[model samples]
Target: MAKLYVIGIGPGRRENMTLRAINALIKSEVIVGYTPYIEYLEELVEGKEIISTGMKGEIERCKLAIESVREGKNTSIVSTGDAGLYGMAGPILELAKDIEVEIVPGVTAAFSAAGELGSPIMHDFCSISLSDLLTPWSLIEKRIENAAAADFVITIYNPRSKGRKKHIEKAVEIMLKYKSPSTPVGIVKNSGRDGQEQIITTLGNIDYKKIDMLCVLIIGNSMTYIENDHMITPRGYDL
Candidate 1:
């Protein structure tokens, strides 16, 4: 049976990708993904038939992958970070009925960014994407507020984009109602990839201009703190 593998490449870096993910790509006759993600795996996908599309073309890309699978071609749909987390897996599964699907998970952006910023997600945490394309801003804002109130170490994805310039600012304002201005915040850009950058700043001192879609913002909980330039959140371990 032809299998459709949903593989997460993990921060768009070969080193960060799991061996299982690489094997799935190797077995796949066709590689389908967003243009930028495809370019990230150019070397690995050199001989495979590439079906690339731009952002917001997820349904089309998933359909192409499904079509390839129906034609007896082993297809792998690539996504950056964990396929289940704001990646292509969900859409692919939703579109693929009566089709065999295998999901190969990889390191998510939150974990990748956390590694570069130290251990900021040691305790309970919740991830939320700020992009209001599919989900309404009202819901995203409410989630931010609830996460803030719960004091969960928050990992924010799609923090900012060109048109959503003030979204991050608004999120910060909501968080401030529950969290202190001095709460630790870690910003990691291009995590696990070349030209990676990390910044440790307080919630009050965050430079919204320094963030972009490619970056992951980790807003610490009430228990989080910065020491020796590392954002550390304790998990109730007495030390």
Candidate 2:
């Protein structure tokens, strides 16, 4: 049967990609993804029929991938981090009709950043994207407030960009209403990939200017703390 595999490439590195993701790419005849993400596939997609689009071309990419599957070709659409999280998986499934579709989950940025930041997300958490392109700013604000109020360790994605400079700042302001200003916050950029950078600080002291779309912010819960330069959110364990 013709199949469309929505694969998460995981931080654009072969080592970070799961074996199943690699096998899915190997089995696929057509590779579709954002241009940068396609580059991350590197040699793995060599000699395959490739389809790439630039930013704001997500719907087009999904249609192209679905078309390839309809033509009886095994196609794979790639997403950096987990395909299911703010990636191609949702669009592919929404637009695909009468086609076999499989979601190959890969490590998300939250997990990758957590690893680099020393387990800041050891407890329950929620991911919130600060971008208001598809979602309303009001809705995003409500979610942020709720997440903070619930005391879920929060992992933030797409925290800042050129046009949306104040989004993260506003989010932090909302979080401060519920969380302590001294709550540990870990920022990781290019997590699990080359040129990775990280910062361990508190909610009151974050250098918002240093954060960008490529970075992920892990805001620790009440029980979270920074110990020996590593962010740790204990899981209620007692020595």
Candidate 3:
């Protein structure tokens, strides 16, 4: 039976990827993904049929992967974070026909960024992407407002891009209506990959200029705090 593996590469680092992800890649006769994510596979995808596309080519990649699988080639389509979370898994499953599809989970940016910035996600949390390309900005704003009102620690993805610079600021504005100005916010760039950088700042003090699309921001809830430069959201454990 032809099979398609929807795999998550995990923060663009080989070590961060799950062993199953690696094995899936090895078993695949063809590799498909966004261009940058394909590079992260490095030598693992060597000698395989590589189908890569630039940003916003997600549907194309999914179609190509399905085509490859239908042609009797075991194919692996990769996404940076857990494929299920704002990754390739959703579309692949939605567009796929009868081909066998397996979703291989990997460490998402939130968890990777959280590990680098202490434990800001130790409590209840929700992730929201600031990119309004496919989603409407009004919807994004409403989600941000609800997450803030619910006091859920928020992990923001696609916080900033060349054209979407003001979205993060708008999100912060919505959050400010409910969260305190002193709420801990951890920003991590490049996450578990090379050139990783992280900083624990406050909701009132985010240097928006320092953020980019590669960055993930974890905004702490009311119970969250910064101690010893690490963002910590207590899980209610007794001392």
Per-residue CA lDDT of candidate 1, range 86-134, in tens?
Answer: 9888888788997899999999999999998989999999999999999
Q: What tens-digit string does per-residue lDDT give for candidate 3 at 123-230?
A: 889899998988999999999999999999999999999999999999999999999999999999999998999888999999999999989999999999889888
Q: State the C-alpha lDDT per candidate.
A: 0.94, 0.94, 0.94
- The regions of model 3 sitting more than 4 angstroms off are none
Residue range 10-78, candidate 2, lDDT tens digits? 987789999999999999999998898988888999999999999989999999999999999999999
The C-alpha TM-scores of every prediction are 0.98, 0.98, 0.98
Worst 10 residues of 1 by lDDT: 39-48
In candidate 1, list every pair of residues with a backbone clash. none
> Candidate 3: TM-score?
0.98
Candidate 2 versus the native: TM-score?
0.98
